[model samples]
Target: MSGAAALSRPRWSRLLLAGLLVLGLTACASTKGPGSPGQKLDPWESWNRKVFNFNESVDEAVLKPVATAYSEVVPSPVRQGVDNFFGNVGDAWSAVNLFLQGRFKIGVQQTMRFAVNSTLGFAGVLDIASEAGLERHSEDLGKTFGRWGTGTGAYVVWPFFGPSSVRDSFALPFDRLASPALVLEGGNSKAAIIALQTINARANFLRAGEMLDGIALDKYTFIRDAYLTKRRSFEDDDEEDDYEVLTPETPANPQADR
Candidate 1:
């Protein structure tokens, strides 16, 4: 009976966690601002803002602290490789989009580019994109929707997930459910995957985070704006993502979206 109960326990726990993650993400999304007062908030954007804040709080309280500690313990190169591996995986999405758009040459090239480069080329150390004179682009579901002319619904801060816009907020549930991060079975397997993902995420942003440390007056605002910009850049035009509305220091007009 005890052994049976133990087996059931994990399945139950996984279900509970999955439910909680969805509920939490929904609750977070419902709380975003409408951009400002007097401007009526888009219903969707308002929700996104809430989620975005929730995500940030969770990151600060849990993930960021844990990641910082892990970084201190783990050597940087290992962490970098882990990051490269994940990035390469996400790059597959971009390659697909490019292919669907009839840019088969670019898509096929990127598939081989990210795979061979990240694996055999020492995790993108050789910078194959630069060598081949091709741009290295990021693609994800959120960005794909944006390419279809979707407006960024609202700014949302999710717990532990970081800043997200309205459109991207909607994409989170699907992404999380389909995520490789959740596939581990055994206790040790789960632990190993979590550690690797967390460390890789942190390591991937180590340089950007460090750069922000030097430039930001308010870390929260800085991260929020930077993330929003970067996410949009991934989907839409480069200019849309590059313009920063930081107070006391505004960026110059970005080139028109392509």
Candidate 2:
């Protein structure tokens, strides 16, 4: 097991331990940037960074190793094919969301095309992404919410999950419950399929570890910046537009009628 994987043991799941870790390591456990909890920086940004570090420590110890092991057990070609298939399905969701944002009808159509081609043309043997009129477009829930005028709120690092903004974090519950893997949850013959998919996701990301390992400075900052930038790229609207918050004082007073 890698050094990070060992430290992610869940025995440290106690709330007290988590709280103490966050408070005590606020200084050392942060990114090198100005917006960290210990730096007296931007309050929201700092809070997010602190949370990110705490979460990263957890993922490094547990998820990374498990994912690494899963990678080793699967055949490379099969893993790649399965990954592409999943991406094809995921593209459908992205397309619908992109259309909802009114930005890139071509993206929506292409994503759906990928889904169809991967399902039909490839005979499940490959993704057939290139064969169909499809292309890759990366985006996630945080960016979608940002485009809709949702504030990023505070940064939080969830154990075993890693960095998330407050707005982005709430979406996790729905995302996990609705993921394709959950399709196997209710049936009796699903155990094998679910296990296989899990392994495939892990096995396919072997290069990810090397990429992560190559980071020279604070891992927290690297992750946070990457996440934020990627999220922003998905948003099609001007996020900085002034939003009107409903206040009681601004409401039409019934007393004015009297």
Candidate 3:
């Protein structure tokens, strides 16, 4: 394959997957069973599960192995620097979203951290902001919409993008526009950078995902529940805080703690 073709394949594949899932969801909803939980909230669960399976297959075939190799071969310092660079870029956009959500104080802190890290930290290859006691913050347009009282419309499994909701899916375009990958001029370069960032992020979460294996009989439900809980908790919109995910036990705490 040509370089451009190879670079574009995964991006197009994700878009295609999303279109297929959306079409399938419409069909699946009509044939729904009677006694489902939060039917309106997750009416597309059957379709979502199929999309989730495809995403998992893609991860196993490509992303996960690449991420594993990246973690093993790349030096810790280099990986950390790459992570910091991308994180600093994200914080810049997050600051704007935070401000839009009417969080002036945290907005200022996020902006300042980005500034300090970008300049003093060698374009964010070093995290000088953290050393200076300026904490990191994460904000996205999804949270901005939530703050404005938009309900998370339906749970969606976005192919390679994994889990999201209708509200978050709507916010994705704005999020993409703010990404550092968009700053790169060359298409190939942008693709490579995005792939690198994805792998690095996945590598960081490898341990947490591995921990889920022995704890849950249904990994799909476990992941979906965990994801929803985290999303709801972010904006303090969690109507219920009692939900828990199973975790491996330590000798110090034999019983699971909720």
Candidate 4:
């Protein structure tokens, strides 16, 4: 599992962009009336909110229930094994992105982790690498963009995918290639694997989603803020995965997706 893939808290990263928006909003309120709620950073706030709402609806109606059942019905060890299988698939790509971002030592370590897990770890149903001291690392293209000085662009909520900046969204297509499941020889096709990954990932965060339900006066804004906060904290993050990183394009509601 990725360091960022915790099932709780919606696991944010690369989200400092929105924290800046909060600052902007404060300044805007101090100078202008409260009616002027525009954020210079979030030029697409209106559109983003619409997509965010739609995604939430889908989650409530479909994703959340299915995930709840999966969690309830599946044994913890089995669920963990499933997650491990998927996560090892991601390490291959994360390693590549780590190298791309110029973190050669970490990249090499991750690559070795993948090799060991796929073989000795029984195709990653077990996390042998972590036991051997090679903890998982999340190095997606979004972080890659951040590393090379590409600023996180407008905050846009992808329709079914959740929060992302323009730059990160652009990398989704290329990142899809990194998923080993995409080329799996069995019955699971690329699309099916992606769907399973989404549901499993959503299940991991069920508790966090419920907690957000209790606290968010505006769910959309709350998720947006949490994600943006997580994103911004990317440079200084090193946490355990709640087992969500199914692929490189795993969308941003993110660090969770990692």
* lDDT on C-alpha atoms for all candidate structures: 0.57, 0.53, 0.73, 0.69
TM-score of each: 0.59, 0.62, 0.76, 0.73
Tens digit of per-residue lDDT, candidate 1, span 1-258? 799997998798556544544543454445544443111212344555566567667666776777877788888676655665666655666787656445566677678777776666575544555466545665565655455444454455565666665567766775554334565668787777666676667755666767876988866555555565565454232332432222112223435333
What ranking of all candidate models by lDDT puts the best one first? 3, 4, 1, 2
Residue 183 miss distance in model 3 (angstroms): 1.3
Q: Give candidate 3 regions above 4 Å deviation.
A: 1-40, 235-258
Which ranges of candidate 1 are over 4 A from the true structure?
1-57, 100-103, 118-135, 177-191, 204-218, 234-258
> Taking the tens digit of each residue's C-alpha lDDT, what string does model 4 give over 1-258?
665566433433335434533443343333322221123235667778888879888988999989999999999899898889889988988888888778787788899999999999999999999999998887687777656555454566887767876656767676766665667777647668777777788878999888989988987666666665555544223432222211222244445434
Q: Give the poorly placed runs of model 2, Cα more than 4 Å off.
A: 1-61, 122-125, 185-199, 235-258
Clashing pairs in 3: none
**Residue 253 error for model 2, in Å?**
34
What is the alpha-carbon lDDT for the whole of candidate 3? 0.73
Report the number of backbone clashes for model 4: 12
| lDDT, model 1 | 0.57
Best-matching candidate per TM-score: 3
Q: Write the per-residue lDDT of candidate 2 for residues 37-90, one digit (tens) a residue.
A: 323212355556667667667556765687787667767776677777666656
Error of 4 at 211 (Å): 0.9
Model 3: how far is 25 from its true place, Å? 16
The backbone clash count of each candidate, in order, is 23, 5, 0, 12
